[model samples]
Target: MHSSKRKHIVVPLVLYCPLATFANTNPVAADDRLETVLVIGEQIKAALQAEQALTPGNVTVIDSADLYQRNIANLGDMLRYVPGIWTASGSTGDSTFFSSRGSNLDATNYDGNGIKLLQDGLPVTAADGNNHNRIMDPLGARYATIAQGANALTYGASTLGGAIDFTTPTARDTEPQIFLNDGSHGQLQGRVTTGLVAGAFDGLITIESKEWDGFRDHHQQERKGVYANAGWQFDDVVKTRFYFTYLDNDQELPGALTAEQFDENPYQAQPAAVIGHYQYNVETWRAANKTIFDINENSSLSVGFSYEDQTLYHPIVYSPFFSLLINTEQKNAGTSLRYNLHVNDHDLLAGINYGETTVDGGNYSHEAGRRKNMTTHVKNNADSLEIFLVDRWQIAPRWKLIYGVQAVSAGREVKNITVADGTLYNPGADYDSINPRAGVIYQFKSNNEAFANVSRLYEAPTNYELEDDSSPDNKALDAMHGSVIEIGARGKRPLGTHNKLHWEFSIYYAQLQDEILSIDNPTAPGTSLSTNVDDTIHAGIESLLGASFSLDANNNHRIEPLLSVTINEFSFDDDSHYGNNELPAAPGYALKGEILYRNSNGFFAGPTFDIIDERYADFSNTYTVDSYILLGLRTGFTHADWEVFGEVRNLTDKEYVSLFSVRDRAAPNAAILQAGEPRSVYVGMRLQF
Candidate 1:
């Protein structure tokens, strides 16, 4: 039995692997190759190659093998080596907050801004751009892709942070397997995956269950889920896949504690939370399909459709005096189409994405731990449509030029179903915009390239922001618009050596108008609110470096070192209250590094470290979370048909705030913190047949 996180980091290992046949997520099955006649094959190549060659931007690809080495709890664990994204995690598996490009610096909710989430090449985010982060199962994913900024235009995403996609394994790549894991705080996980391939038909299914007693008091969760997919090949040129997903989760919330309370007892839940029995629970079901057709040798077309249903029950106590019981039923549908063409030295792609979501919900008042009366019943509908085109021309042998344009339309509508106290839903609002991009890349050296790009970004307000008619200060929230310019480089060392170094680095600057930020009302405790900032600046650097070293004469013993870090200097350009002060929440600088030594006989051990600089807790910067460092040790034995791993975290047992809620102008007494978990141990094992 064991004790106990790389994704989206561009490395030479992925680029040079010749056996990477299933890297692309689409309707095409891995074993759909046609051995009969000259079938119009080659329709299943990964889009990453085209996008990387044409777009002057950063791209990261993480394969399943990469995930086996780390903890598979949340997206935060999977995106550890990812450069641009920042993740702050909570006690439960799904209680994680992550964002890209410094978007919405103060809010820690699941509604992702500036970043789009996708599963198997289809949108997981609702039409209003809100994502249920729990829907993803990292353990079931075969690979993941990260597209940064405008480079994600091909995916119909034009946010400042970019897009990320999770791809599942198919029958061709799956074998009968079982996994078991046990960790600190009574955490247990069990999963099984099996698949079968028969002639032109293939099917795969996965089932998983998890239970955990969290590091913090009252933070407990139980989860059960299933993922299944079936594929058929009509011919060598046509293929399609149908998928289904189901999840049921029960989670207890441990409300945030005041800074003073956290200092005295990091593991204790707020008294009000315990008394009110705060909880967040949901049951979700989803179905999706993807099809691919090869028009000819030079072109291909892919289409995807999805439908999702979810029911949620949220009970929380914002303060000792205020509580809420919110129940919601939601329906969401989405469709996407993309066409790719390659002729001569030119690469072109055109795509459209459309999604609509409807919410039938109400918010009720609660007396202490019991529901009192219904306060507001409302229905909200949100929709988004986007069309985009990208063209890449290789004007010279060493240079490429990329140009792109996108058109978007978004709308939100609300209806007062049972208004007890006037109407709490805002009047409907609609938004439309057109954005353009240009970029250039040069192959300045062997296996190395330099890139630069400029793009315009637009983000629409989520339903929550546009429908906050009850809040006088939040009713008029505006859509956000910004411009970004970036330059970067990626490559590996010289070719004739056993030891190689791989690296990628980029720097970006963004100027934004109407940047959305959290605004707290001193009178309404625990109510989330947002307001637009007139001007803001976001500038940052993203980097990943890795090296392989030979330590023995036969190269049987080796060492691998990896370092990933992000440096941010985000601030309000000029505002009445914030002036040019740095933003709150995410640390200004965070670094993670690991060094592993391994023998060819399937034995490996490593030392890993995380360092985070001090950060302000609110816009007023009245207080700060002290800087912290964590040291960990991991070791494992990996062999054919069987593997096992163990790890220990927080060797120093340092006291630190893992996450916090942002406030408006506040004194030191107002900041609330979620303390980091104490030292822990984890162990896991897997069997394959």
Candidate 2:
């Protein structure tokens, strides 16, 4: 007989209930009248949790409640606690340069590649796997989910870094709220949000504004955004939701500093940035719709569509004589169809995902950020199609077999409208790949489980990586292919009657062929080129451990300690040019942890620390970035309808390099290092009605 405990509800749809916010205000009467709705909402959450548990790889779910308690200025600040991830702020604070599983470690620009970003399970990253412009603001998300590596097969993501999905908050879980934040370096931010629920319709709207004069000279940034969504429930089995978003982001780029300048003053921008008036600005508009249909008790279908339009204005130093100004108009559209079914002892998921992006770009010669002449104009387009299927079959009482496959086709096309230099070359390509995955999950106890999997990954180069090369040895770029093997375990155990301990640990190894890598040209100091590497290996361990202990018999006071660690070993596998040499960029190890004391009356204080080891800065391993330690503290008070928090970071004011541009060979005077922020403090408060 099939085990009843193993029977799980599968729903690919995300719906918001109408009475959740109301119940928060009038608890007694609302609870009496809308008890069933609340239960159904909880059931939806449980179903999502079940889906995550069924996966044979590492997955992390972060709630907005936990995020709001900290200073969330950017994506790097928001996801700092997650394991197997590395992130640093780029030229501007709003842009995050991130890497996962040793992917995209050589990127020097603000637009990063190698990972998939999604909103409500739909693609937000361009079809070419490029994270262009500014990443979405995390302030409006209700929760976020991260599927590491090939574990994201269900989402049609076969990239090395896997996928991240952010779910927006609806009227169901939101109320009228206001927040204000202020910190060092003239930083200020504010947000206002409200929600409505009537009959079968519900909606939520939020507006946010933020600005900061950063720690370094010439580093200034501003942002304004609006997030709104409306849902209509036609019946218990049918629901449709519409979303709209608008964002305006503007920032001044502080060019990287040389070793001499950094030692003299890490808070000064390079002279080139001031001379060229470097800046990156963008405006964006997005809209999306999702509809769900419950065909039967054990089957459901979900359809989604999304569109985005963006305009970018960027200017930067190209040479001592002049600057380069880049202007681009970009558009993206995507659609998804997913179906979930349960039969006998198997749960199946099938989906199709399609997306396309077009960019009309122009390069202009400029002086002091003023456009003078158009040098180059081009139009680039990328489209992708993915078909995937996943199955979880119960083979024994305590064991389950998980298997999946994905078929992908992608095309990158470039049209040279005008080439001022008289060189006409078509550097476009089409790629196709079929990847398969298999795993086993064994549940040894009700609260403990272990899993192992082997999967394949493939990624097509982005348009940026396919740029025209004028070298004699240049050849057509090929797609990246790799095979990954992973093993992991997660569980919760009672530490004592009034406390609990929870832990998650995983290890992964990948053998890659034709992996895309970029390095600054040895002949040209400012320009970079991309090429495929013959052989490489990426291996890493990710772990998180946490526990809470009550300080009193009444459990009115508690102490909690949480730790996260990531160890990386990325190296070349006996290549022609670089034989068994370690890769540059990511550090060998990272450790972060916090110890907190909490009281039942909603007060908490914590001390946190982060330690990052040394890493190389050049492919030849000639230069090294020294390891550094950072200290911080957080104190906060929370209540049902209000909260206040304070934070201090880099207490010792240690000067160190946070990030750097990759190079084939680095000079001692090269201007490639980006300085880390110095000592700073921040405070914020929130109110809800």
Question: Against the true structure, whose TM-score is highest?
Answer: 2
Q: Write the per-residue lDDT of candidate 2 for residues 27-107, one digit (tens) a residue.
A: 334444345434554555566568778999988777776766778988888778788888877468688888888888774
Angstrom error at residue 284, model 1: 0.9
TM-score of 1: 0.91
Query: Candidate 1, which segments miss by more than 4 Å at Cα?
Result: 1-50, 132-134, 318-320, 367-372, 416-418, 469-475, 494-496
TM-score of each: 0.91, 0.94
Cα-based lDDT at residue 335, candidate 2: 100
Candidate 2 weakest lDDT stretch, 10 residues: 6-15
**lDDT, residue 74, model 2:** 87
Error of model 2, residue 54, in angstroms: 1.2
What are the per-residue Cα lDDT tens digits for candidate 1 across 18-122? 222232233444334322101221112244444455568887777665566656777787888888778887745576787787865765354566678888779
Once fitted onto the true fold, the runs of candidate 2 whose alpha carbons sit more than 4 angstroms away are 1-45, 468-475, 522-526
